[model samples]
Target chain A: MTIVSTADLLAILPELLVMAGGCLVLVLDPLTAKDRKDWLAYFSLAVLGAAFVVGYWFMGALTGSPRPAFSGLYVLDAYGAFWKLLLILVSGLVILLAKAHLKLEEIDLPEFYAFILLSLSGMMVMVSGTDLLVIYLGLELMSLSLYVMAGFKRYAPRSLEAAAKYFILGSFSSGILLYGISLLFGRTGSTTLAGIRDGIAGLPPGDPILLMAMGLLVVGFGFKVAAVPFHMWTPDVYEGSPTSVTAYMAVASKAASFAAFLRVFLEALGGIKESWRMLLVAVCIATMVLGNVVAIVQTNIKRMLAYSSIAHAGYALIGLVVADAAGTASVMLYLAIYAFMNLGAFAVVTMLRRGGLEGDEIDDFTGLARRNKWAALVMLLFMFSLAGIPPTAGFIAKFYIFMAAVGANMTGLAVIAVVFAAISAYFYLRVVMVMYMKEPGETAGTPGYDVRVVASPAAIAVLLVAALGVLILGVFPDPLIQAAQSAILPLK
Target chain B: MVPIFFAYFALVSIVAGLLTVSLRNPVHCGIALLALLGHVAGLFVLLHAEFVAVVQIIIYAGAILILYLFVLMLLNLKTEERYFHRRHAWYITGVGALTVELLMVLLASRFSGAKGPATVAAVEEIGNSTAIGILMFSDYLLPFEIVGVFLLGAIVGAIVLAKTPSPADLSGDER
Candidate 1:
């Protein structure tokens, strides 16, 4: 008898394509001529496009019921498909963003493309995994690639420092996660979601072992999503890494982690909602309050966005606290919109490079409006969107999340989130204020500073796609909302 | 007799673990690690997980410990002047308290989880390695395959981060 059937192969076709593409890129990296290394990025884009097409094609089969594959270790469903499509889209945009930024940073190794593809495959596996072991392995694959990419500029001390800190902390978090899995396995005798649910069905609500395992899992996932107390490495790593890698980490990695986070919590642990909901509320409030409050004091733009991403993770956690179908759908909508606006913001940051100086500080935007009006305009759009201003996607993402909270009788949590949202607006708008209000060469630290925007075609394309996505989703969100609604059915 | 063996392995493993961390000399630390791994493997064997026990000895004790020794010898590492600082007193206290609390909780809680099919009799019937092989290839095929990609990524990352930079790469940096 065959161990894996044709259906199993078909279920993982997209992931296989991405993995093969990554290997192909790695194999061709040294063979490709130096001047033609750009072809690798294009090839990786093609690979992602192919995977997207395949994944989208499979969405039809995944709409109603979840299909278990590989002896139920993996599942094919609209929830996974939705996140996979979003991840593919984000990775594609990141590749477009990276192409020009890598050249500007003088770290244009073709292995960068390979790592992106490999990490994308890991994310695909993560979203689809039905077993905790599979998810952990996928997380490792994704993180190892990112750890390397974060220090792609190997000679830079800050880059090396970022890589070392991230690797060490990330491994510690993974160990914690594995320990949680082991505890869970000891309590339930299984690692699969279905098995664990069944195993814990008869357990008391406050069973010490079960609660401990759940708490550890929350801490593990909290670290991955960079929620508040576990968020110490975010600002440093984001500030030190290349802009493109930071963008990928902030958008794609966060989205994938949130996807897995939602799956494991809602599907496996949904039975004990009351027990976990209070714990999540505490974490959610702390994350939002600390992330938004601390962000107001950051001098570097990357550090500000890192905190902003942390705050966004908190907003998404509100959905987990609500613990309903609406809550899950709201998180999907929020992350999808978040990917657009955050990437748009980072694309602009990536383009602010000129000569040897990395213009990553808030002061770099002192006179950006005068230097490049169009660039300043897009940055304005992204900043407004991130700040949740009306007529932008961020507002809509927050609206759905808070609406879900209120629907679930979490009005108090919703109110607290709205207040933090209001507070977060101050820092986001500061970039806009500096860009439009300040005069060229007005800052005292440097004289005759020419803030040129390196607007390549690829970067412009990414900006356009992201800007259009943010605007279109804000105005006409019916399709995505409906998609998210259907996507949560299996979990319910 | 079984309880006696268990006590000996557990005690020695804990002591070696502490020594691995607290030892001043790197080589001595490596040796402590080897003892710790061996005792851990012995404990695994006592639990009837012979496959894991043997693999642990082969991988951790044989391969990984050798690697640690090679790296220590290559660096020609010296004994540290000071292992602990006065400032770390609070940290040590905090960690010790947490460990004690955890131990208290573990000892108090009763673990009555659902039992698996891998009893000693069944393991003896099917053999440990064969049972593991069947499970790995059948039930855990997907995770097993993903581990391949995971290790491949690790290798690529190790090479990318550690390999000497090419002339062209250095020139690009200067430019």
Candidate 2:
């Protein structure tokens, strides 16, 4: 007989707004005129704007106090709020990119916006989820939505193949995660993250169930993060999925998953640091090495980005390896910066993929600097950012993570990560070399390459993100660093 | 008090699950899955989950199995048609099933409790649908709505995917 209070509703207003917006878009999709498919874009943009407004409202009250907003399911604190705010911002940018990208692909999908919101809703839940069960549920919600988004282009056989593979692999990972949860639940008799912390503290050393559950859970998360040995699905999936979906998956989903990983490992299981930290370091090292090396050989831009994502997961895992507030903060900063660089790159690539054809191969962009200066420059920015070169967000993100690793006295791992980053730079620089050094080849189907029509919206988003991300995080990094530090405050 | 119902239900359900996976014929698999669904419903009944049993029968047996059968009839599938089927589908399915058994062994060692998991509050109250529904509406409300949202997404995806006019071919036909 409990009455639903406005305050309670307001606590989850962002999630509610996202869900409502998604449904409203879905409902309004078919009822609209055909040329007005772009209205779906406007509707989604409006919804994200409203979500940002709500996030702003929440931020006004954020004195860094952690409140169990929904009877302890969600902890409304700086950390969760920070991730949520970024998620809201990223959701709109990706959606904005998709509107144009889908039109360029000649596939008018109003539902695409709705799906993005759904996935965004899932990520928000995951980042804010204080309970392990809620975490699993959010993870599934995100995974399922993403599975479809990957295969949205049903006409393409490869896309279908990619979807099937992703589905099977993702479901297997979910099973492993759930099994891990069951093991943890059996050992602790509690599913709450806070309760798990207490239960682990009470348990004896060399606890079998705790160790096993941790192992299984790490395996599960390792798949989502696309680290080594568990990353068999990444290249195929990234190559198979549409570029827009790939960008969202690579940046948004990975960020949210890492956010949850940070919360689960650092917050709940903080006491057993020595045990889990070793495994994470090993995984981090492996991911960094493999992602960079394999990416060098990739011909497809999507596959290369996929491998880069894996490497960045390695960078992000640096945050986990350190297991400190600074490390956590660096992760938040890295993720925000990454969304802009990665999504912007993909958005431009999607627009360039004209004539209902797939994107141009690496060769098609030969002398892109001559063909489309803006896109070429944007690509150069993305490449440099990803390569951890000077004056870009990517550099700052990598520096912060590496510095955090050094702070934790893991200079050896940090040094290894630096070497891999250097190796990764070779491939990224090669893309730039293709654009600037080489001549534009006899690449056919380059008709829809005007890019002025396409580049403005995507470029505006990408330039804003890539430029600001690189500059602000690099030049005026203190505020961002502080925010990143504060964002993890809830966990501690 | 009613170990017979529990035992019978568990035994039949397990066997049906095996049959469902093991059977080569699609229709037979549907029927086997149905059998499994029924036994699970019986277990629900024994566990004081009358509503769950009814819902289980309705959803699993009625809806899901029917869909399976319909798909089978529609596709006219001769066999499982799994990749690497011609080489060793039966053999692989056998090995795959054995591997699943091995996994069950591992899972039991890790997750299962002795005798019954009657310790949980949800278990002690009842396995009925009402308790689950109450939990869904009261505690797990967000997840419930999210699932509904997921279903909506799925439907939209299905429509998009199933809507077929080859753009390449259609371009020529477009007035």
Among all candidates shown, the one with the greatest TM-score: 1
lDDT tens readout by residue for model 2, A212-300: 78988999999998988799999999888877788888888998898888899987888788888888888989999999999999877
Mark the 10 consecutive residues where model 1 chain A has the least summed lDDT. Answer: A442-451
Model 2 residue runs over 4 Å out of place are A1-3, A353-356, A442-459, A489-492, B1-23, B35-54, B79-130, B166-175
lDDT of 2 by residue, B1-175 (tens): 5887788889899889988976777777888899899999898778677777899999988998888888788998765454445766678779889878866655555443222233446555664455566667766665566678777777877776677846653452111
Q: What TM-score would you report for chain A in candidate 1?
A: 0.98
Backbone clash tally for model 2?
Answer: 2
Which runs in model 1 stand beyond 4 Å of their true positions? A442-444, B79-83, B171-175
Per-candidate TM-scores read 0.97, 0.88
